[model samples]
Target: MRKYIGELGLIITAFIWGSGFVVTSISLDYYSAYQNMAVRFLIGGVILGLVFYKKMKHVQKGTVIKGAILGSILYLAFALQTVGLQFTTPSKNAFLTAVNVVIVPLIGWAIYKKRMDKFEVAGAVLAMLGIGFLSLKFSAELNIGDILSFLCAIVFAFHIIYTAKFVKTENPIHLTVVQLLAAAVMGFIILLFRGEAAVPIVDGAVFSLVYLGIFGTAAAFLLQTVAQKFISETKAAIILSTESFWGMVLSIAVLGEVITLKMAVGAALILLAILISETKPRFLKAMPLREKV
Candidate 1:
């Protein structure tokens, strides 16, 4: 049940993050990518950091170092993804980002000597196919942004696995807070060098920034850190990959967008992948079925 609780946390993280696309779009309209995120994570870090100050104060140096390492990897993931988005179509960016689901198991196999189980390999294959259909264009031309997005997937896979590893010894709250601070610090340095460090205040920007900081960055990452304690990296990635499906649902339900048949099929495949990963579905059962009368 504790494991289930952890999986539940990851699912909620995916939902909050899926919903974040909207506010993120709004926030981006007001500032440059790194500039906006610098503010987002800084604000989030401050809020959660203050609340967890007592815990953070007592944390060992090793824990802070672990969080900083996680945060650095996270910054690379976000930075690459953001820059990639600027250069490519959103669909392509998203599909490429979702490739992390497949990358995680491979990383696990290579780094931990944990071979990919049949179900995980099958699920990753299914998820990749689903993502391709859901988000990729047949004529999707290769470009620098696509390369960056793919690299982002690799880094994100590392982030997921490392977070799982680090959370074993450290408190998730302090880890989450420090990770936020790490990203915030990187964002600050990058924007500082570029001279885009100042952020302007406005109602729309403020609302989006607040949402991204509180729920999107703070709560979502915290949930992921805590959730990883109960789930394997591969299982966690498979579950988180469903965020694309949820994103599509939000598009249709909240944005009044029409669902294309292609999207429906793609969504079905992704759901099928999730079912395959989490349960003993008939799809993965062996051999000939009993004949029906």
Candidate 2:
């Protein structure tokens, strides 16, 4: 029961992130990617820094450096994702972003010589097919947005892997808070360089930025840091992979987007793949029956 705690945390994180797609879209109307990120992370970092002020005592030189690395990766990942959504449909961006889950294990296998089980491999294949059904139209030409989203997927995979390693040695809340601050710092530097530091003040933008900063960036990422300490990065990725599914559901239920047969089937396959990753193939296999006397 205790072991499953991390999985629960990750599921919650996924749900929060699922809402991010829509909220971010709203934010993009007011701020450029860097400006939005700059504002979002600054708000998140300050809030968490105040709320968890007690955790600051644990901060160390190593923590600062590690947090900066993680935060930089996070900023890049989120920046690319936010930027990519500009060119693609939210649905496509969400599903393509989830492709990082499949890439995680492959990265581990390649760089660290880590081996993936057969069930995990199967989940990857199923997930790939699901991605195609979810986002691809089998069109002759791919858009720049698709390419950007795919790159976002790759960057996120690195974030997941490195995060898993760092949380083991550092304090989760402290690391997470510093991570936000680091991203904010990087974003500010970018703003300084690009001269887009000034952000418009509007009611809708304010609400969107608050939701994104307080919940999406602060709460969700802290939970991820704590959760990944107990779970394998791969399993965590699989669980969070459901973000795309939640994105679809939220679009249909909240946004009143119409659903299609292909989408329904694709959603089912993605859910099935997640289940397979969690339970493995053996759980889904039927048992042999014996004749009764």
Candidate 3:
């Protein structure tokens, strides 16, 4: 039951992030990418801090260190993806970022000396292939954006790995608040350095930013941090990869985007990947038969 709850939390997180795609499009119309990052993180951090002030007061030094590491990695991953998007097609950028689904298990195996689970590995691979089908255009061209996006994927994989490790010893809510605040600081620093620190006051921008800050950044990440406590990092990545599927569904519903055959195939593959990872099927199990006298 706990495990299922964790999985459900991750699914909700993915859905929130998927919904972010549409809000992001709207937000970008009024705010720059850097500004969006800074504002959203700030809003999320403030909200979390206010809501969990008592917990925040008891945060440990080790938790702060772990949270800072996660915060830095999170900022770097988003920075890479945002910059990569400037040079690459959105589809390509998204597909490459989703590569984190595969990298999570590899990081565990290579760095932590953990044994690879065959079902998890297979599911990760299938999820990556599904993302490719969902977002790739088969451009057959390599560029700086592609490289950066790949690097973003690697960083995101680390974020998941470290979040799982850190949550074991630290309070998840405290960790979440600290990491969000740290990320907000980093975003602000970058904005100041770039001389783009001005905040947007437009009503639509405000609404979009607030929605992202609350649901997408704060709630989604808090849920993810809590959920990782109950599931393997690889399985978490497999489930979160469904963000792309949710994005497609929301796009179809909200933006009236036409669904394609490729989208259907990709969504199916992602579902199958989740099923495979969640239920390592055994085909050779014997069935008992009863005879009536």
Question: Per-prediction RMSD in angstroms?
Answer: 4.7, 5.7, 5.9
Candidate number of the best lDDT = 3
C-alpha RMSD between model 2 and the true structure:
5.7
Q: How many backbone clashes can be found in candidate 1?
A: 0
Q: Across residues 155-203, which tens digit of lDDT does each residue of candidate 3 receive?
A: 9999999999999889999999889999999999999999998885997
Full candidate order by TM-score, most accurate first: 3, 1, 2
Q: How far out, in Å, is residue 91 in model 1?
A: 0.9
Better of 2 and 3 by TM-score: 3
| Total residue pair clashes for candidate 3 | 0
lDDT by residue (tens digit), candidate 1, 48-134: 988887877787898889999998999999999999998998889999999999999888887777766667667777887787888
- Give the clashing residue pairs of candidate 1, or none: none
Q: lDDT of each prediction vs. the true structure? A: 0.87, 0.83, 0.92
Deviating ranges (above 4 Å) for candidate 2: 85-92, 283-293
Greater TM-score among 1 and 3 belongs to 3
Candidate with maximal TM-score: 3
